[model samples]
Structures are given as structure tokens and as C-alpha cells.
Target: MNETTLTAGKPGQSEAKNNKMGRLAAASSIGTTLEWYDFTVYNLMAALVFNHIFFPSFSPLVGTILAFSTYAVGYISRPFGGVIFGHLGDKLGRRWVLIATLMLMGVVTAAMGLLPTYFQWGILSPVALVTLRFLQGAAIGGEWAGSVLLTMEHGRQDQRGRNASFTQIGPSFGTLLGAGFIALITYVLTAEQFMDWGWRIPFFSSVLLVVLGLWLRKGVDETPVFKALETSENKADLPLKEVMVAHWPRLLISGSVRIGSDIMYAILMVFTLTYVTTILGLPRSEALTATMLGAAVHVFAVPFFGSLSDKIGRRVVYAMGALGSIIWVFVFFFLLHTLNPIYICFAVVVGMVFQAMMYGPQASFITEQFPTRVRYAGSSLAYTLGGIIGGGFSPLIMTFLLKEYNQSLPISIFASIGLTVTLLALFSAKETANKPLAE
Candidate 1:
């Protein structure tokens, strides 16, 4: 791996490297596909259905908030999974831990689909939902790091950004698959039918995805980097302990780097569904269609941006994304306010495009902040910490603000704070796009 090989992000890679990466990418994609599928569906259910099924006794607005609180619980639980599984990933290897995380998410998500509503279960219904959501969050927390590392570590040094993009596609494909499935169900089922049993079908379908993921990942091996670490006497040296004691400040900065993107995603993908329906009095299907199309375009855009990061720089692409979002969010709301379907679609598509710029290079950028020894723990901890403040609670906070003020201004203000934090992180952080990973 000399300069030429490292810089040959083009088609000059050996046949062996390409074939190996293709297999790893395929395996990693399926598992992460399941992760985001659950993510999109669960959040949609929390916003649209859970309020009705699990908290029918409360006011509609109050129930939405409570349902979102349950959604928040998952985020709150992510750090635990990050710490527990991150340590395991570094201690053991990235491959098996991912399998475990995949299975955990599958079982827990299916359980949510099987759960009875409040009328049938009394106080147990909502409680059970929260618990399941927590486990789902934990699974995702661990899955992200392993997937990113598996691809990044296995691929050529120059191609890390593109390789990591495969992992990033999880959300794109998962959101598409999940949203498409939900949309089909909603289109065919009557409100009564959807409320009764249709919602459960998606949850139960997780088993099939988990099975597929297991088969694909079964043949995948541990990353060469981790295998090398295993041969070393230190073997990363208590990854979690090393990360926290020596790299606490990095955690804060890396975590805050996510504040903007998370806030943007929460608004465009999550909160917009609620906002369009409840605030603007738009049809539920309209909002869904907008986001579905937005996510669809992202499938291509994400990879392109990832490749672009290799050419220009990771920090440049990353900061540009945050800046674009800060400017575009206001436009997103304005378009939605028009109540024109075409503009609505445009707004959301552009919104997702901004996300593509950020998310495309995200895995490599963040993971590069840590050395090989502490990467799993440091990266995972930073990721979950960002989740807690950014994606985890942004929707809930925005919803409360909307209810309190009857305006979108507060929402924009809050999102700006998240993006601002990201810019600050980029300013303080070193550019790692052209650099080799620290040993």
C-alpha cells in the first residue's frame, strides 16, 4: 500500500481488493438496510399510529408528544449500546458483533409489531413499546460502527469515503423500502384496518430481513486491520477506557458535529410528516410521497457526494452540507407553506440532497478522528452522544415549540444551532480525507 495504491481511488485497484470489498459491501448493506427500515417505520408509527393505539386516552397532540417520547427513549438508550457493543467490537471483532446487533433489532422490532394496544394491555402497552424501542436503538448504535469500520478498513485507503458510503446507503435503501412498504399498506388498508393489524405486518416482516442479513454476513470475515490488532500484544488496550480517559474532548466535538445533520433529518424526514399533516392540514399520503421521493434521490446523491469527498476533502464537503442545510431549511418550510405538491416535493428532495452531502462522507470523517485502537469506542461514543442531543430529541423539541408558539421560526432557530455546532467542529477538526488512518 504505497502512495500510488493509496491515491488510486480510481479503477486501478487489484481484482482481489474490489471483489473483497464488493462482498463486504453487500453484506453490510443488507444489515444496515434492516436497521434503517426499522428506524423509518418505527418513527412513522410513533408519529402517526402509536398516539392512537397506545395513548388514545390523551388528546391527539398530547399523544403525539408521548409517542415521540417513546421514540426519544430509543435515542436515550443508544449510548448504552454504543458503550457495550463498541467495547465488544474493539475487544472481539467487528463481524460477529454486527450479527448480534442485527438479530437483536430484528427480534425487538418484531415484538413491537406483535404488541397489543392500550385497550388490550392497560398500562403495559406503552411501557412495552418504550422497552422495545430502546433495544432497537441499542442495536442500531452498535451496527453503525461495525458497518462503517468493516467497509472503511477493508477498502483501499484512498477509497475509504466511497467504501463508507455503502454503509451510509443503509438509510437511503432502508427509508425507501420501509416508507414504500408503509405507503403501500396505507394505500390499500382502510383507516380501521391499518389501525387494527396492518401496522403489525411491517414489524413481523423484520424476521425475513434478519434472516437475509445473517446469510450474507455469514461469509464475511473480520477486517484486516482488526485482525492485525488481534495479533498485537496490546490489542487496542481497553478501547472504552482509552477513549474516555484520553479523548473526552474529542467525543464532545465529534458528537456536536452531528447536531446540525441530525436536526435537519429530524425536521425534514421526521417532523415534516407531522407538520404537514397536523399543522398545514395536508393529507398524510402527500407528506409520505414527498419524503419518499426525497429519499429516492438520495440513493444516488449520497454515493456521488462520498466520491466527491475523496476528490475535494471530507471537511469541505461536510461543512458545505451543514451550511446548505442552514440556508435551505427556511426554503423547505416556505415551500411546504405554499401547499403546492410540486414545491413540497422539491423542498424535501433538496432537503435530502443536503443530507446526502453530509451523510455521504460522514462515517469516514468521524471515524478518522480516532486511532485504530480506540476507534470503535471513541467513534461509537461520539455517535451516540450526538444521537442523544441531535436526532434523538430534535423532533420532540421542535414539536413542543410548534405547539407552544404556533410558528416555524423557533424550529428554524433550533436547527441553526445544530448546524452551527457542526461548522465549529469542522473548524476545530483536522482534515482527514487525504491522510491515512492513525495506527
Candidate 2:
């Protein structure tokens, strides 16, 4: 097929095509939501519960470090997942690879609920947990790229930013679900009961979400861009190799742009839970409730910013977000220090909104950098690498900074440095909101 034919459908599509795109976006969103729900739950558990359950022998500080280390292990595996799955999604198709990722994530996450604690199995428990976490990381490594591509490739060109935003909202919705569920569990169970078994329920319940994701995803068609690539016999056989050779700079740009937003998210949603309960002497329920509320705001914030990107441009909105992070990091910690639940909620919610401005337009921005033939591999590699730099070790770094300096200033400076990198990257990137998909 020619580029003309590939782009021809847009000018004359009826309401039927529009309806199909809507359904496809919904399915993609639901699948991504489940994927992030499993991920967010794991991060929350790593922060609040895993140290006690899996690394019981260590001192509190050491245990928290070790727990976050295991959390980092998952992130370490993500790039590998991206390379592997990105190649397949580029060479094969988006649909089956996404289904495979969903199943892999669900099974491993549920298995986490059944694992023996350190007391029951000694060194083996943490080892097993880390192994499962790695696999979970790998699964999500490919999930985000595929989810975004599915929606964007199927969506109207003028609305790609808004459509891609649907996928972006997954993390926020997942955060909401994960935090809300944990809050509910904590509220209902005494601390003793919670430590004993409450955490497992969320992990185990992932099976239900997996089934729903599978059902929803299975009903959708492969994206039009991928379909066009197949018809043109232009699919990349070694997508990663191609991406490395021809698009490395764009990959670096994509990853850099994500640093500020990703780090902000990791700190707000995961590390803050630990910071509040441990340092601020707040109740666990209070922290979780604040996070849940923040995530709820993020669900709306992401799409709003995403749609706004459609009008203004991805880079402008994204740079604003990166700049916001550079300015807001100090305020975020200050609000947390106030020990007022209201201030705490404001901190988390407002911080996430700033991050959302970046994340909302991020999907289409990165995907547009590569041609259809290698978009999956290129975008996934950039995203997962960004996760490694920006998110994987953020909590550990924050913990170390706080422990060594005994103040939030060091962490705020660390965040500022990352956002500065993102701002530089935004300045270097082309405005891609109105670009047609490369053939």
C-alpha cells in the first residue's frame, strides 16, 4: 500500500469508523489500567509492606533500602522487556504481544500474593519475590508502548494527543485503584491483620483484572499503522538494531523528556507513602488516602492536559510540566513536612498534575519520532530506559539523600537536575502534535 492509501481513510471516514476508534481507545485504556494497577500495587507494597514481609532480618532503614532494591530490580529488567517485546510488536503485531504481556503480568502478580514470607522461607522468600518482580517489570516494559500505539494508530490524526491521553490515564487510574484498595484494606484491618494478610488481597485480585483486560484487548483489531506496514512488507525484522543505528538521538530525547515526570510520579505515588508514615509520623491510612485522592485528580488532569496539547502543541505543554516540576519539588516536600493531611493531599495532587502535563502528551510525542516500521521498538526502548533513569532508583536515591543529609533539600535538588535535563530535551525536540504518522 502507498502512503496516500494509508492516509486516505481519514478524509472520508463515516461515523462507524469514529465509533470503532472510540471502542478501541476504551479497550486499550482498560488494558493499560490493569497493567499499571498491578505495577502500582507492587510499588506501594515495596514501600510500605515488603520490607517487613520479605526482609525481616534487616534494620528498618536497611530493610526499606532492600525492599526498594527489589523494586529497582523490576525496573532493571524493563529495558530488556522493551527490546524483546518491541521487536515482536514491530515484527509481528501489537495485539498478541499485548495479550501476552497482560497474562504474564497477571500470573506473576497473583503469585506474589502466595509467596512465603522471610520467616517462613528465610533467604528464599526475598529471592523469590525479586524474581517475580523482575518478570512483572519485563511485562510492563512493553505494555505502555503497545497500549499507546494501539490508540494513536487507530485514532484521528487531529485527535491523536487526546486519544493517546486515554492510555496515559491508566497509570493514574491504576494508582487510584491500587491506593484506594490498599486504603480500604488498611482501614478495615487492624495493623496486625494488615501485616499478616491484607496486602495479599490486592495482588491476588489481579487475576480478575487480567481476565477483563484479556477479554477487552482480544476484541480489538490491530492498529492501522501496523496493518499498513504488514501490507507494504516494511516491517522491521530487527527493530532494536534499526532503532539503535538510525534513531538513537531521538531515543535519548524521548527518554530525557520523561525523566522529570517519571521521577515526580515515583516520588509522589511510591516514596511519599513511606516518607509520610515513617518520617512525618502520619497514619498509614492518611497517607494512602491522600495518594488515592491525588491519583483521582490525576485521572482527570492527564486527559485535560492531553486534549490541551492537541490545541497548543506537545512540547509547549510538556515543557511547562517539566518547568513546573523544577519549581514544585521543594514545595511538595514542604507540604508533606507540615503534617497536615490537607496540605499533604495538595502536595501529592498538585505534583501529579504537573507530571500529567508532561505525561499526557508524551505518548504521541515519542511515537511520532519514528516511522511506523520501527515505532514500537523505538518508543518502548525510550520509555523503558527513561523508567530506569527517572523512576527505578528514585525512592532509593531519595531515601539515601534524606538519610545522609537529614533534609528534603538534597532530594529537591536531585529532582531539579532531572527536570532540567527534560527541559533541555524539550527545547531540542520538534513540535510533533500535527505531524502525520511516518510511512
Prediction 2 TM-score vs. true: 0.97
* Steric overlap count per candidate: 1, 0
Candidate 1: worst 10 consecutive residues by lDDT? 1-10
- Over the full model, what C-alpha lDDT does candidate 2 score relative to the true structure? 0.87
Model 2 Cα lDDT, one tens digit per residue, 98-196: 999999999999999999999899999999999999999999898888998888887768888898888898888888898888888888999889899
Evaluated against the true structure, the overall lDDT of model 1 is: 0.87
Error (Å) of candidate 2 at residue 236 is 1.6
TM-score for each predicted model, relative to the true structure: 0.96, 0.97
Query: Candidate 1's error at 136, in angstroms?
Result: 0.7
